[model samples]
Target: MTDLISENLQNKTGLVIDGAMATELEKRGVDTNNDLWSATALIENPEAITAVHKSYFQAGADIAITNTYQANISEFMKMGMTKKEGQDLIIKAVKLANKARVDYFRLLHKEDRDVRAAHPLIAGSVGPYGAYLADGSEYRGDYQLSEKEYFDFHRSRMQLLDKAGVDLFAFETQPNFDETKALAHMLKLDFPDQHAWMSFSIKDPETLCDGTPLQQAIKYFNIFDQISAIGVNCTTLENIEPAIKNIRAVTKKPIVVYPNNGDIYNPETKTWKANRQAETFTDLTPKWLDAGAQLIGGAVEQHPKTYNK
Candidate 1:
């Protein structure tokens, strides 16, 4: 097993770092704007992404997600790139992460730390289709595609990411069972060596959009041995409690939970922001950990200091 997954199995609490937009922002000389997932594909600077990963490492994060959440062909087609071009991005993404790992070890060694002797883990992030797959919206959805098509779409990227040597294969922001099954199967077929984990999104609805109960969804996927953990992210902190509670009822596998900024106060607009005022690293993490969430992280609006705080 890779060190990342092994540590996750050992350390009950694994920290997640999301720096999707770090490269894009640095290229344009801007800070993060939209959700990092979309804003990240704008810039192509692997070095900038590495620096952000380093910051997350310093923040005490055990796992750092590469900035390739939207680096799939279907998503990149919007940017006018061909399928091959988008696929090549994965190789580059892996190299970028390896660079981040090397740099992080160098920094730690300089500070008299032994992180180099220990193993480090890098996760290659796979975000949902730019549109929903179950019930595709007119603009974002492109729902006409069949389930097999969706699976095939993601399959191409999975193959490339597997070759890149990511410690695990991660599917994030999926809202239903169709997505979960399709992705899990593809990963098993192509990247059997890597671990697979799923994260569902919380909308206004009670159950996830695919209509599976939280526990059932996890139970169904647990049949696959490669699933090291199951949890949720990119949603409200309020959702974390219910997610943890439900997921805990089903399986004993490690639980990973990362909530977005929860109820933040906006200075200029005088408004409370969920993603805007999202949870800091310190706030509410203890609640999740105490509540049996084996892993903790910041989803939307995640900063490197989230681990430090």
Candidate 2:
């Protein structure tokens, strides 16, 4: 299997992943107040999803993550969609991002089109099972599931994403260590050709949301060759540097970090509160790179323009 991420990083300082998809879609006037969140656009306003992807690419992102983070089969089915309809929406998410990549390139100058860096990769966003609960269990990581249960919940969506041709999987914002271990095992056993970057939701610099030691969780996957990169996401800006340093201490793989804007999320109300003391991505990107992050981006409330240097 080709290490697509490594190929893209050969001569680059770092790969810039696109900013938040749910919040970006909300800015485009798509109502994301529902459980579907950004995936609601897949049915109500798909073009807005495509437009969001294009905007990120134009903002100079090296990777555009698909908006399937909350678009699992069970969630879509609960909305009165059939099983097949739910699967199609996941595939559509990938297509929209792929179209944005294609359309963005056509808008570039002919001379610039041939450059490797100008071509962006599409990462299929696989959010944690907690995202499907739509009650903010992702941040808590208190849910428990047997290994088979975890694999069964995730396998179909992964198959759909892989069949749709994503460059890689973004097993991101994961909180449970056992759940992630199940996913890693499933990827190596079932989808051997595909690779993914795993980013955890953490409680602090040293602990995962589920109470696992950050270094222990990261070190456990050192033997899984299918995991291409490892780090943290949807955490505080203050946590990025220490998390990256911790990750660097355990593995030589690329470090991917995309923390939330200074705001803090309240899952009960599905709202965010401003944190005046939160550091800006502009003020922190270089520090993250210096701390050994090879791939960087933003989480909630972070707009594409934030990456426009």
Candidate 3:
């Protein structure tokens, strides 16, 4: 397995991941009201995807997650594209991110580039199956699938991402315990040389959205060397610290946390409303690092300005 994440962590306090992709695309005047979300930009406004990735790198992010969070083959087929066309879009997502990385590095002064802690990484975003459902089932984790079904749903995208040359996978916003296990198993059996980080959608500080205890979930992946890091994401700022403590108590592996900008999501309406008591990343990043978060970032409603802090 590659020691990409571990090697980076050994030199820095924490690696900063890029902020939200879909929401950032929305700010650039892209239409994301459809089921495809940010992936729509892959076909219609690919240059915007590259610009977003470069913006994050400029904002000091150490990783740029590709815009494939909702770009699965099944969804593409539903949009009237053939299977080959859909798979091409998935590969295109990684190419766009890599272009941004190369373009960003080329613009940096040689002295500035040489002073970097580690090279910025491209994380192929493997969003949960609920993301394809596009109804916010990711936050509830109520879906069920047999072992073969889960494998069938995720395998093609993983293979495409791997073939496209992602530094690693970012299995972010996962909520179902069984689905996470299936993904971990798939990584071990099918993509033996690839490494990934698994970040969950939590119900509270103590449990996953599917009701598995946070400690139990963290422990389950402790033996999987391929899971480079384990933590939570797409959750509120308030939930991060306690969840990190729970995860750190169970594993010595790196912990990745990217909580949403404190806003309440109405899955039914697919809109966000302000949270009066929401905490800022400036106020919480130090606490999270102290509590054991090794990689930190913002989720939906966050932007380059948020990460620049």
Candidate that beats the other on TM-score, 1 or 3, i.e. the better one: 3
> What is candidate 2's lDDT per residue for 129-181, written digit by digit as tens?
99888899899899999999999999999999999999999999999999999
Instruction: State the RMSD for candidate 1.
Output: 5.1
Q: What digit string (tens of lDDT, one per residue) describes model 1 on residues 1-309?
A: 553664644633444545334433444455433333433443444556666666666555667776666566665666677877777776777777778777766666444343221356677777776432222321122233457876877787777877888888777766656667778877677676778678776552235655556677788887887887788776666778777887888887777776556654332332344455444655676677777776566643344334322
Task: Give one digit per residue, the lDDT tens place, for model 3 in 1-309.
Answer: 566998777767788888888778888989887888889998899999999998888777788898998889999999899999999999999999999889888898977665554667899999999988999889999999987899999999999999999999999899999999999999999999999999999999999999999899999999999999999998888899999998999899999998888888776665678887987787788899889888888743333233222
Candidate 3: segments with Cα more than 4 A from true spot: 299-309
Model-by-model lDDT, in order? 0.62, 0.87, 0.87
Alpha-carbon deviation at 157 in model 1, angstroms:
0.9
**Alpha-carbon shift of residue 107 in model 3 (angstroms):** 1.7
Q: Rank the candidates by TM-score, best first.
A: 3, 2, 1
After TM-score superposition, the amount by which residue 57's alpha carbon in candidate 2 deviates from its true location, in angstroms, is 0.2
Scored by lDDT, model 1 comes in at: 0.62
